[model samples]
Target: MFQSIPWLESNSELWLQISIVGLGLGAIVLFAETLHRLTGNSSELARKVVHIGTGNVILVAWWLQIPAWVGISASIIASLIALLSYYIPILPGINSVGRKSLGTFFYAISIGVLVAWFWPLQQFHYAAVGILVMAWGDGLAGLIGQKFGQHPYEVWGMKKSWEGSLTMALVSYAVSCLILLSVQGNVWQTWLVPVAIAIVATALESVSKLGIDNLTVPLGSAALGYYLSQLLPLGS
Candidate 1:
């Protein structure tokens, strides 16, 4: 059911889902802000919390079967908010992570893109894969890499550690496999798709410039998984 508009009357769940989505995202930001305050304004950690938390909203959309337009609308709105935060303190703990990067903005855009691509097709699981990949994979990779990454290397003038790259690969594979397995069941495509997506996602994350990885990794992983699954026979 669609949400009712002015001069229109009918049953619609659109506004309900939108309210849930708004509350969900708002809670994430509130939690992140609280963390920032408690931890002496550790923007980086708080930002990661927001990163991981916001990405999980795809799950909510999937479970509720929210309409594509609503999801896309939310994403576009979030992207605008993220972009605006870059110049202002609108998202104090998020954009000002002491880094010159557009990862937050890119992340929001990727969500919108994935929802627009998959929701209408009723293949929202792929959207889940993409968002969770960015959420857990990239989020954990950054955290673990900074904390444990010892051997560092530079890619296109950006420094990264082997530890982080490995984390990204393994996490991407797991997230992909988990979501895909549920959608396609135990099958060859399930294994192969995640493996390929994982490899590509790691490579994308490694060469990320100005946070472009936020855009590339999830889109690439989800698209690759979709195409690869189409090629292989899936189980029921």
Candidate 2:
């Protein structure tokens, strides 16, 4: 059955690329684990290390032109491992956020969904925008909020800070703009899409409960980015 799938076929170059991606991802997890255990780092710190680091895999997949099947398969395997980490110590440092969460699982699912949605369309920029927003935007927000969040507020029983939200918005805007501008040129839509995506991503992240934004932010940002890109078109 697998033989019939053309994507199943692979070349030596593909294998090498796949191996590099795997090792890079493995090294990230190992580094997070080492940081957690050796340095007595907080679980949240270790998890964010993995979070910010692993979300970068989208770049690797895009750069190497990894097949959609491989991306999807890797996501599925990652989702399973994240789910299992709740019970087992598989990369415990990455998931031990000191609270109930399926953030890791949702994050993995976002990758698979983005690859499935845009890989065939050859619009990888949207996928990159989504994951990078989550990686840099959300990831940096958490780090900044933890360290320098003096003005704390509550959103639907969730605590947050303006500093963090601003970080998310700014990073989301920057990430989307850089990706879209490179692909779509210096158009008004390019500017508008990033602003829209930044607002939407920040809103979704601000009210996230139990890490639901992991699923919502990336997929939502990508979809909205693509949608607005079509609606606004390149002009002005």
The top-ranked prediction according to lDDT is 2
Q: List per-prediction Cα lDDT, in the order shown.
A: 0.87, 0.90
Local accuracy of candidate 2 as per-residue lDDT tens digits, 1-236: 44464554537688888999999999998998999999887788888988899989898899998999999999999999888888876666677534488889999999999999999999998999999999889999999998999999899899999999999999999999998888988878878888889999999999888899999999999999998877877763
Q: Estimate each model's TM-score.
A: 0.92, 0.93
- Can you tell me which runs of candidate 2 are displaced by over 4 Å? 1-10
lDDT of 1 by residue, 30-97 (tens): 99988888788668899899989998989999999988888788888888888778777876777773
What residue pairs clash in candidate 2, if any at all? none
lDDT accuracy of residue 151 in candidate 1: 89
Model 2 has how many clashing residue pairs?
Answer: 0
Error of model 2, residue 21, in angstroms: 1.1
Report the error of model 2 at residue 31, Å: 1.2
lDDT of 1 at 147: 92
